[model samples]
Target: MAVIENVHERVLSAPAPAVGRLIDRLGSDGDPLWPSPTWVPMRFDRPLGAGAVGGHGPVRYRVTAYEPGRRVEFTFDPKIGLRGTHTFELLERGPESCLLRHRLVATPVGAMRLLWPALIRSCHDTVLEHLLDNAERVVTGTVSRPVRYPLRARLAVAVESVRLRAVPVPEQAALLHAALPRPDLADAFSVRVPPGVSADPQAWADGIFRNPPPVVAALLRLRNALVTPLGIERGDSSAFDTVARTDREVLLGVDAAHLDFRADVLVEPDEDGTTVTLSTHATVRSRAGRAYLAVVRLFHPPVVKAMLRRAARVAVAPPGPGARPEVAVAHG
Candidate 1:
């Protein structure tokens, strides 16, 4: 049997007990570990202890040993292609310093050897680094060094960028009404404006889609190039229809590009400024929807950032003739 071993460790600027407490809660519900933006966070069926069943993403495993605040070990299910034990341990180096470590010892049988080194290893390295940084933030007030994406993860992101540009525009919305929660995967953006500025939610939506920011215009050009060749027609601002409205909330429905999206524009007035939250809920119902979304997730943050930046511009820019009256003065 060929055995594969891997280990990652970091020295935290906090005491062992502090590090232990964070480790104990790793995969349990309410786990505080910040997940890698590119992958699913770990989840456990129960608290860390012997016989607990849980894993991250598609991997499944069971706890083989446990020591609260000290160490815990997980043995992967053979079905996952790796027969091995992975353990998390904390060691006190000083009264106020501790070493946090993850050690995995496994035997790769069948096709796992290829999968482990190529896909699994890259994902594991990136996620583990993030996990350690999260622990450091918990122990210390801040992380001295933030997590940096490895080469492989960066390449994955580049591939995602190209795919986003190539996505086709759907002619109509998918009729599937099964709405999922705001989705842990959503990217959100917000802007604050002084209460005196009264921007009409409808007007804001109209401007947002009608005159897109430069970043968005570039994306649209890419989409147009791809769709034009396929003979698929493009949609305009008319595609964003106001479906629901209230004094404080406006929901604009969108049907475009293989996705059904609801843009929720919420305004909460305050003494200092009115806080605006622009949240977009999206769903894709194709047979490859899951895979499509995974790729989309990598690109979601940039989309939100561009939209919010543009909306802020719209709110603050002075009205020209019939220009949407400058209603909200944006604050960073």
Candidate 2:
């Protein structure tokens, strides 16, 4: 039964009307504010107005108030034990400048009472500051100082990415569907592409092949050693040929004496967020392939999942200083 009130405000060197326009676009396809890709994007069921129902990630709420260019407020759903309202307010300071503010006034209940100060507040503070940074960048075309994600925030993001699950090879995975029309073995795992991160299949593929986990690298070495004695081909990036590719998907595989295998890396975007799916399809061509598959199948799922999770973590990571000028622009 503790009430928490937090506020973050920024004075942008822009007119209230211009800043208000950005606020109006929150949760839309081309949102100019609200940091994303590094964090989940804010979304609403219909649009940004009173009665619009949505919130980013696990926090759920409905729009309790709205003012196109001046303000908007979201009241938390009681089921989650957060009873309060978070809002965005715009105040005109001058014809050429305005103050943008985000305030959170809520009471945490049950476990949230403990978790709020320990965890949620820090993450919330970082996100709100980044949101203000984005507003400055979108309107002023630059941010005087961009907020960098702290270690704890990075760890929180990593923990959340672990929850991503295996799903059916989606129809949008055209390359996978075409390459493995009928295959003896098939599986797919997906992770949401953070907003602002590159959705290029090549980028995601590089994540998988560039620097795999030590365990995965060790497994690959063992696989190569065991297969070499059987006169089977050793797998590596060089061994895989690019069978097909498009903006959304890349198909890479090798046709070995014992088996034919293909890996499809796909990027699909929907209302929720962009998803990167990694799918494997293989067909045994010889008796040796069957025996090899039996052993490999046991470890394949986890290996793929780990690789995807690693790539996602890398993609969403905040860029180190001097890494690239565009990094902040994208996140902002």
Candidate 3:
């Protein structure tokens, strides 16, 4: 096996003490610093210190060394193909400045050997950049240069992105009213109920809206994770407060706080099936908003697509064997 190391550094405007507090907060439960939405939120079993086990998602590690207001190191257990130590250090630069550095030294074996160079490395780079930006923001009150997803990442987002699903309009308008996913959230909702379930659109819509589809809930979690860091407001029912719902279509608007723009989701029946299209038509009011939107646009489609697929699974699924007739829901 060969050694792999990545080092990222940033000069913060604040003193070492303030910067250190931010670093120490990483991995602790409820830590204010949120990583990029693409990565799992950092978590730990106990306080952030020596011997405390922590990592993001399935990546587990133990704090091997700790120095309050100075440095900390995490040594990850070997799993699949990764074994390494990641260290963070604060170096006082001046009376009101400090240099924060993160270093990852690891050896990748087995499948990880190829995976590291192929995928993890790129994502790690982006995450590290985001981590640095977040650290500086706590003390500087702004991130002058936000990180953007690389082209490779953007391409991946495009490849797996979900599009509209073709759900046949129920024979009765009431069927559509009932089967539709909740429109309260500024997200795309699609579902096809089994024949046994009430086909009335109103009934389906009422029940669906009462308890958001699992996929929509999961999507909201990711949405919150991404927008909270940027200080953007997440969409709620107010997104549709101004829209009009008709027997054939539902028109709603969505706003992204701090970004100074609005998006709309158009739910209408096409000749083939119902089509839900999410479109943003507002001019970005600020430079910062434009930059932020540019970065997030790549992620938006994939999120919508995933929700559609999930909705398809839930809406068309049989309650029991031969409980009801299955309907064909195709992705458009």
Task: For each candidate, give its TM-score against the true structure.
Answer: 0.54, 0.83, 0.51
Worst 10 residues of 1 by lDDT: 162-171
Residue-wise C-alpha lDDT for candidate 1, range 274-320, written one tens digit per residue: 55666666776553445555665776667755666565544543223
Considering every candidate listed, which one attains the maximal lDDT? 2
Cα deviation of 152, candidate 2, in Å: 3.4
Q: How many backbone clashes does candidate 2 have?
A: 2
Error of 1 at 89 (Å): 0.4
Estimate every model's Cα lDDT from 0 to 1. 0.63, 0.81, 0.57
Candidate 1 — which residues are off by over 4 angstroms?
34-38, 154-216, 219-250, 253-332
Question: Model 2: which residue pairs collide?
Answer: 37-194, 37-195
What does candidate 2 score on TM?
A: 0.83
Q: Write the per-residue lDDT of candidate 3 for residues 37-56, one digit (tens) a residue.
A: 23445667788888888676
For residue 26, model 2's alpha carbon misses the true position, in angstroms, by 1.7
lDDT of 1 at 97: 94
lDDT of 1: 0.63
Residue-pair clashes per candidate, as listed?
A: 1, 2, 14
- Model 2 over residues 124-240: C-alpha lDDT tens digits? 888887788888877877777777778777777777533568998778877777766888889999887656667677766866767688888898899898889887888877644
